[model samples]
Target: MRIRIVGTGRAVPAERLTTRALEAKLSLAEGALEAVTGVVERYVCSAESQIDLACAAAALALADAGVEPGAVDLIIGGCGVPYQPLPATAPLGMQRLGMADGAAAAFD
Candidate 1:
């Protein structure tokens, strides 16, 4: 079988937590976290769930691929936490993207 990556997408919350903020939260010296992690800021969700973020990213990826949600054959959820307890998060993302019949896989 031949496999290829067709598209890509990204989404981030409106709220932003800078490295200085993280340093303050951790009680570390200013710029310490940045020195260690090399990250200047982080996006935090105010109202959107992780699932919502994932779905948004997936929608963009599909759009970039010029593919509709129904055309998706498989969906993989890479979140560390599941959106719900009963059903898997991958299916939730797929459903949110309107791909109810697509196959799904959830990985940490």
Candidate 2:
């Protein structure tokens, strides 16, 4: 079977931490981290857990696909490592996405 990607989404935290701030926090010289990493800034999650971000992104993806969550037949969570071990994150993600029943969930 061929897999077709219908839509994509991303959820970033409200907090924006710049390289300068990170460098200070790491006690590195100004511009040192960015010079090597090429990362100017990063989103830092404060209130939202990783699951919250995933669910928000999933909502956006579903909306972008012009389909309700019930339309999804399967949920495949990638990135290997769960944010924390215990009560697999995919099922939680499926529930958060409104996949109350019928959808199969898995992780890679």
Candidate 3:
């Protein structure tokens, strides 16, 4: 079987942080991280739960793919940050997306 990446989505925090802005927080020279990483700005997740971000990203991805959330057979989320200690991030995301219990799986 050939699996398809029907949807792709990304989420960034409401707050925008730039390399120059971080300089004050880290006491580093301006563009110091940017010089090495080539990243001028990065999104940081807010106090909001990771599941919220995942759900938002998933919704966008599904919309881009022209698929309905209930039609999704599976959902795989790979994130460096996780929302909680007990339950995996994916289940929470699935719940947020209103997917059936067995319709999808999430990984983080």
Candidate 4:
């Protein structure tokens, strides 16, 4: 059997959270956030909903895989933060991607 990485994707926030920004927002010392998180800069999706980011990533992944939107056998979306308290993010992603009208099963 041959195994291939058919699709791969990543989700990044539309906005960027810089060390300076964090310091200002949290009123912390310079580099305090980076020291604690070990990250100088990070993407923040707080501005946009999680479902939106997932859909974007999924679209890119499907395109890279060279597969039609209707050809996907399965879709799995995982995230620590979800857009809403209820309703899994994957269904919203599928709907946004125009993949199958809320037919895909989603896992947290």
Measure candidate 1: CA RMSD.
Answer: 2.5
Model 1 lDDT per residue over 13-38, tens place: 87999999888989999988889899
By summed lDDT, the worst window of 10 consecutive residues in model 2 runs over: 99-108
TM-score each candidate.
Answer: 0.79, 0.85, 0.80, 0.77
Query: Per-residue CA lDDT of candidate 2, range 1-108, in tens?
Result: 777779788898899999999999999999999999999999888988778988888899988999888777677766445776655677778877767744765453
Better of 3 and 4 by TM-score: 3
Q: How close is candidate 4 to the true structure, as a TM-score?
A: 0.77
Model 2, CA-based lDDT: 0.80
**Tens digits of per-residue lDDT for model 3, 1-108:** 878997788776797788888877999987788888898888776675677777878888998899988887776667676567657788778877877777865565
Better of 2 and 4 by TM-score: 2
Error of 4 at 11 (Å): 3.1
The number of the candidate with the highest TM-score is 2
Worst 10 residues of 1 by lDDT: 99-108
Candidate 2 Cα misplacement greater than 4 A, ranges: none
C-alpha local distance difference test of each model: 0.78, 0.80, 0.78, 0.74
Model 2 clash tally, residue pairs: 0
- Give candidate 4 regions above 4 Å deviation: 1-4, 101-104
Report residue 62 deviation for candidate 2 (angstroms).
0.6
Q: Residue 25 CA error for candidate 3 (Å)? A: 2.5
